[model samples]
Target: MDGGFVYGGSGLSTIDGKGRCTIPSDLRSTVEASSNGNVVCLARHPDLPCLMGFGTTERDALVTDLKKQWEYAQQRGENFDRQAAGGPLASSLTVIGFEASGRFVVPPMLRFFGKLEEQAFFHGNITNFYIWNPSILLAQETGFEMQKEIAEYFLAEAERKRK
Candidate 1:
């Protein structure tokens, strides 16, 4: 993917009873550009409590990266468990389509994995963005200070809107 198609910025969206949430505008535009459509690939983040989302371009890149890793391991005469290596990226991936308004239904398994509920806090991370349960994000410790701050800001904005 081109650097211009990177995901960035942050926002919040309410999850309705049907599990629908609107992707933030900036992130949505990036997804459309990188995917060539409104489809997104979502999966449980390998090391985070949130879910990670990306366009088809990133998904293809993951395949390329895995191939490179396998080749590197073969050259060193090391055994590479292809299944173990690609499981996280491929196993739970779910492809979803959104409307022009950016609303999409979060699959049940992904919703559970992400611990999402009433609201989702979106934080962009260059190649992909994270969809976090607001409370889960706020409760996180250590290296997530910036993400926590962004979640808080959006939470506060939502609160203000309600007032």
Candidate 2:
């Protein structure tokens, strides 16, 4: 799939008890443009610090890639130590699907990570995204920027955006 979808900048949004957040207008546009109007939320685990929102096309491509990698490893007799490593991105991912209306749910554990008090930010991470609490993003003191190579490496919506 063509990842030419331009990632709009990040913005603040609120989360409800059910963990739903409204897609920022620009983000919606970015999602609509690339996804042909559909989007999905992805989480590595409820214990993770951030969440990812992805376009369906990217999601599918990632799943396919992951499965291929897993298969190759299996064929090569990659050891249990190696098998203990990575799996299908789907296996690595947990997600919430969304409708065209622009509201999506975050997993309960993810919501707890930020003590999510209604506001969060959606930052693009090239192949995926970061759904973060505003305070968490601000609390970071590291001079390093995440995904420095993301924008150049792929059709990332925003590779990584930080203050």
Candidate 3:
């Protein structure tokens, strides 16, 4: 699959010395459904060290949504525009073919970002696939929960202020 798509899930797999990792057998069927495994996009997401996966279908739709959102932000003002534009995102990975062995070549930059080694987590996040170092994934999960606590604190404060 090499177009816009959407999917999300957790499937355990390992990356070989050659930087190839396999999708779980169950997931393989989904990949096969795509034109070319839907050109899996594995990338890091904001506030998480985990990998996010998107099928080719979701990926294309995301771009459209982002563009619309960006435009809406611009209408709001420079502050909104700045917020949307001030981030480095890895949304431009291409789908490299998979081997008969079921291993796929992950990009070097993505590999480093993911800190991938022998074992990694493969996630299908509806717009792409994310490859994450398992430890990083754990840390990310913990950090996200902590962030929710902080956000709750702020929300409570806002409620008090409103009163």
Cα RMSD to the true fold for all candidates: 1.2, 7.6, 12.5
- Best-fitting candidate, scored by TM-score: 1
Model 2 CA deviation exceeding 4 Å by range: 1-6, 45-48, 71-77, 80-101, 113-115, 143-163
- The estimated TM-scores of all candidates read 0.96, 0.63, 0.62
State the C-alpha lDDT per candidate: 0.91, 0.59, 0.56
Query: Distance (Å) between predicted and true CA of 14, model 1?
Result: 0.2
How do the residues 7-78 of candidate 2 rate in per-residue lDDT, one tens digit apiece? 545555667777788776767777766676665646553444556666776666665666777778788987
Tens digit of lDDT per residue, candidate 1, span 1-163? 5435689988999999999999999899999988999999999999889999999889888888889999999999999987899998687899999999889999989999999999999989999999999898888777889889888888998999999
Locate the minimum summed-lDDT window of 10 residues in model 3: 146-155
Q: For all candidates, what are the clash counts?
A: 0, 2, 25
Model 3: lDDT equals 0.56
